[model samples]
Target chain A: GAGVSQSPSNKVTEKGKDVELRCDPISGHTALYWYRQSLGQGLEFLIYFQGNSAPDKSGLPSDRFSAERTGESVSTLTIQRTQQEDSAVYLCASSLVAGGTQETQYFGPGTRLLVL
Target chain B: AQSVAQPEDQVNVAEGNPLTVKCTYSVSGNPYLFWYVQYPNRGLQFLLKYITGDNLVKGSYGFEAEFNKSQTSFHLKKPSALVSDSALYFCAVRASRLTGGGNKLTFGTGTQLKVEL
Candidate 1:
């Protein structure tokens, strides 16, 4: 089956610019998540969406970061006024369902963002 | 808050030799432990996970891990190593859903494994 996919494999932008990264989860997946991987921060969760309930944004570092998922198909993570610290590889993942603690997450190739 | 630690920055082993990568975790509640491998310029690939019922969990590519509640550890191991196994390894932990921790995973800094032929 098709796995999770992300767009704009690489992105270079100036500081203070905004960027939008897209993710298409596997077919029939009801859970979606976004995470950031950087040399300094390692891997950190950004946000998560389960079915139609409210999205979990507790892991978001700041208000400048936000994500939206249309149903269970695709999700977009937007970083406003990006800073040099925001430079990292943005990864997306999904699972068949989110209710169980045993569900394993399948990851995407990720979008590498460079803030110059 | 849930956290994971991969104390070693790197591990080196010869092909056909046994290999082990250490991982320890701390969480307020019972943990959902997982191991993942990442190849250069690629996404992380899930290896194995320990949710419950078994202390020793086996995963893809002939990898296995033992969940130790006493030590709060989930070290990944393989009987024999392959040069192709050279890559980055990550250990992650999420607090059990019973604790209301949600599904977010806390990952370690990752350990680079170099399998020499």
Candidate 2:
């Protein structure tokens, strides 16, 4: 079985530039999530999508951050006008289903973004 | 609010010695606790989880976690530490009711486990 995967293992960009990070979830996984890992903020959940219902964007730090999932398979997290503070390793994960509070999430290698 | 605490910033153990990584959590409802390990420059790997029934749950890579309802803790343990076990450890928790947090796992600050030779 293929695990979750992310694009652009490393990205270096100037401040104020927008970046789009892609995620390919495991086959048949109906739930996808994005999280950020930084030196200051250990790991913070960014957004989540379950099936086709409304996505949970409560964890998005600001309006500049948004994500979209094409159906239930692929997801992209975009950070508009990126700031130095936004530099971090963006991680994606997926699970077999969405509920029961016991679902295990398989994680991706992550995209390391560096805002210079 | 659901939360997890990994009080120790780091834990060091010699190879062949027993190791423990402490984790405590808080939630409005019953908790689903989990443990994960991360090596440098890699994604996190699931070690084990405690949902119900068993207080002691064994998982991959010879790792196990004990769920303590009274102490609100789920600590990862290995009978004999190996140098390869050195890595960053994270503990996470989710509420059973799916309210408040809504299946979103809350993770700890993480603890660095250094297994020496």
DockQ of every model listed?
0.83, 0.68
**First chain of model 2: TM-score?**
0.97
Off by over 4 Å in 2: B98-100
Q: Is the docking of candidate 2 incorrect, acceptable, medium or high quality?
A: medium
Q: What is the C-alpha lDDT of each candidate?
A: 0.95, 0.91
**lDDT (10s digit) by residue, model 1, range A1-100:** 8889999899999999999999999999999999999999999999999999999998899999999999989899999999999999999999996849
Worst 10 residues of 1 chain A by lDDT: A95-104
> A33 in model 2: Cα distance from truth in Å?
0.5
The residue pairs in collision within model 2 are: none
lDDT of 2 by residue, B1-117 (tens): 888999999999999999999999999877889998999999989988888898999999999999999999999999999999999999998888545567577899999999999
Best by lDDT: 1
> Which residues of candidate 1, in runs, are more than 4 Å off?
none
Clashing pairs in 1: none
What is the CA-based DockQ of model 1? 0.83
lDDT of 2 by residue, A25-114 (tens): 999999998989999989888888999899989899999999999998889899999999999999999999776645898899999999
Q: What lDDT does candidate 2 reach at residue B94?
A: 80
Q: Candidate 2, DockQ to 2 decimals?
A: 0.68
